[model samples]
Target: MLVPRQVDPPETPAKTRVLFTLVFLGSGGIERSVCNVLAGLNPGRFATKMFFHHRPHPKSQQDRIPQHTEVVWGTDAFVYHRKMLPRFFWRLIQEARQADVIVAGQEGRAALLACLAGKLLGKPVVGMIHFDWGAFSREQPRRQLWGLRLLYPRMRRIVACGHDSAKAFQALVPVRPEQLEVIPNFVDGDKVRVAGEAPLPDWAVPIYQKPVVIAVGRLENQKAFDVLIRSHSLLRASGLDHHLLILGEGSLQAELEALVKSLGVESSVFMPGFTPNPHALMRRAAAFALSSRFEGLPMVLLEALALGCPVVSTDCPSGPAELLEHGRHGVMVPMEDPKALADALGRIMDDEAYRQDLSQRAHRRSEELSADRALRAWESLLSTV
Candidate 1:
């Protein structure tokens, strides 16, 4: 008779197991903000794992995830929930059962899945709100709103990246004041400083020689890059010679290119597709512009400020006004007004002293968005529940 050898018992994990669920890993500010939190968390105290319903997009900031953090790519799909809900829910239950806390990023299906899974397993769940609900609901479907009203109150806590987002969310859903917490988006200052101070990549060094006004984000309607291009055309006509460089790729690329050509400012406007590293461009840029119709504490604006570039952004709902502090740090132009945007651009370009002052303030203000502080706030929240 063969004797069975004695097996050693598995040791328990010392750190708190946390699971983060995302509908998809795409090139968005929310995805990058989550990555920043992963980078800053105390690894010894938090064993983090990320679950994605689909694979990360080619241009996504998925690469920013730390080496120690485990990532699981689930079944692939185009949209969140609805048809995919059963599959995602089942998978989430399997993944979330062992975790001490579940933090769900993105709204709609991801939030519903996390909340339901957490409820089933009795795990504490944090619902992360990355968009201004007032602005976001305008584009969402009826069922999404219904789902939010039904499921949001069940979450242990709701985290809003924008300072004003909590108040905006309360108008849409029936969440208690205690359930809402405001934590602004954060950027890696040291990473930005290093990447920005480095020399421009070979491909851009030639065309980027001119004073460039850079804007970074997916080339989508929400970003309103067409408005930025239109404003640039006006600036050119008014004798401003700075070239406009818009980074990131999206569906609006073809239309934006067409608009640039039609406006006859094609030579002055450059859309270089998705750039893996934008901090270098930010470092060399004369100014950064954000023309979004709305936002929830834009990550690019924070990165721009951290890199010491002055900024001009639309006073969109929830974010720009709070970030600029009513125009103390940067210029806040009226939303969707090309004339107003052009005027603000002209002011920054023509006045060297004002630009320098904005740049100094931008750097000083970036310290307030420290990744450590944001992560500590998150850790405290996670531990409490």
Candidate 2:
């Protein structure tokens, strides 16, 4: 009878629940990075939910989101309107209560709202800084800056997409040094290389038939497509004869097209709007170009490197120099300097040996920024926070 004692099995630990909030889930670098992180997370250790202030459009990167994530659209609670902040706030609070940790997918309203909810619930909030703070502050309204100054410090952790971004943020905001963490944007190189092998579309075939320099990003001021267009014109004047392919759609499409016409590079420069796969184009293109005025580690740059495409980028604040390893893996030129960009592009297109060398270096550097490394860093941060 004394030997009949029974013992129960040990209980399993609960998975950490994480809630990520964003203003929208559109086809942007921030959205792509978030999708990658969500997909890379270990399901056994963490459970994730995503909250969007508005419903994603059909063309948005909604399909890229992992299947395991529970997505809640605030549009379901109330139609999104600038005047409906109180309703959105309450809805966010309801969602935040169930999460052990809250993450603002990008800075601005998302950060403010997440910080407020985390404070009220005594939960930790992680705010992401996705742009150079100096450039971002200049573009945002005073109220936005005020809100960030007040709420950013309250965040349990602040993640910057690049080191320069972190430095700019610290100089602008009063957050402690310990609160800041730099996690560069990363790409799944294997997936990128596979996607790069996809055949070019019918329209893009002729463009890629000859030598071409490609740029991919939203056709907006921040991207400085105008600068890229000017650089292309300069290259053509120098008799480089390489076509310019600009991908992605934005409000400034009309303006950029007009610039192309004015520069007399209309026949050579192509604006094809947004494409689901730019990797395919990068794989075949002679060179990849980034003419950004500023960036928070451009994902397109990393994608180009992963495909072993030679890169020529403007030395923009917070990203290009760092991502390119200060001209080791790719060429870096001064921002808005069409001549510098043109010279760099011409060099890559003209010298096959130099281009091949850059290609090898790019591929090697990309391995350092692989998804597996970033995933481990993210898992560590999530588990601790």
Candidate 3:
């Protein structure tokens, strides 16, 4: 059965309709943050809806949509498939007709689609860039970049998930500086705090007996789980004797498992794909590590800080440095350096005094990304469009 939403607001001039467009909602940071924003927005002034270009997977992470927010699904074909683009475009245009503003839930094809729909329908569009666009361009197709250059400028505003992300996008893309806005990812502090205290899952019980380090992110190349695994092996070789528990599923699962076995850290390393609630694990772990090479402001980092989990992350482009306040809040290590990663994780795991201090500071820093502050920033941005 489809999820039900509240009926559309009575036809009135005061109601500002906002439609969110995306390829699909999967077990990723972007989908989770979008769902959080959808649930947190005030309904009194905005009529909200989410349109998906494909069906959500049964195994994917699910979030609660706003009570009355209508959910629409379009063609199920791959987003980049030529046949799917026109159908997705048509669906977006149809949805755009009823919306005052179109919030493109992600960059790439979805942004391109929303930009096309908004242009043809004379509706304002807002594009959300969730990754480090500068680093992303290296792997993006020339044609897609060309399309982005043409379509992005047409957006009323482009929302970057980090301050650095905004600067990176302006430097990497053709969008004007005036069209960009930096809105860091927001965290549900209360929910994380409660969930962190919840009982640990059965599989994680063994981790409690020994020191445990947890890493959570999609098993993609961008996340660089290979680096994390190597670092974990180094820590084990040095007799750190801690367990590494990685959460989330992606295309690299098999490769990562193979690497773990080859490194002889299979017993110490665990890749439990896509845990529904990782907060409890975060709270119980010795430290939380984010080994991404680039990010637009990782929500997982903030979620860990909210739970008072001492974090050891790569000083990667865009988010980590800013989130860690250049090493004030948490330990920041060089990207792709297994030795440096091992040292940082070792520090957090071996030094109880240092770890507790970092945790206390991190918890305090969590206030900066609290839901109330981010919600107001988003509301202010939405109201003007």
Whole-model lDDT per candidate:
0.86, 0.88, 0.86
lDDT of 1 at 128: 89
Clashing pairs in 1: none
Best by lDDT: 2
Q: Given candidate 2, what's the lDDT at residue 178?
A: 89
Residues 1-385 of candidate 1 have per-residue lDDT tens digits of: 9999999999865888899988887767988888888878888889999988876665566669898899886676554556766776788888898899999887877887788888889998888888788887887788888888898888989999977887888989999999999888898888989988878889787667777899999888889999999999999999888899999889989999999999999888888887888899888888899999888899989999899898999998888888889788899989989999999888888899988998999998898767777888988987777
Candidate with better TM-score, 1 vs 2: 2
lDDT of 3 by residue, 1-385 (tens): 9999889877755868999988897768898889888888988888999998886666655445667789887775533466676777788888899998999999777888888888888999998989887887776778866876787888899888988988888886787777888878888889889988889889889877889999999898889899999999999989888899999898899999999999999888989888878999999899999999899899899899999999998988899899889999999989989999999999989899999999998998897766887788888889997
The best-first sequence of candidates by TM-score reads: 2, 3, 1
Write down the lDDT that model 2 would get.
0.88
Q: Candidate 2, residues 22-130: lDDT per residue as tens digits?
A: 9888778988888888989998888999998877776675778899998886665324677778867888999999999999998877888898899999999998888
lDDT of 3: 0.86
Model number with the top TM-score: 2
- lDDT-sorted candidate list, best first: 2, 3, 1
Task: Give the Cα error of residue 324 in candidate 1, in Å.
Answer: 1.2
Winner on TM-score between 1 and 3 is 3
**Could you tell me every candidate's TM-score relative to the true structure?**
0.92, 0.95, 0.93
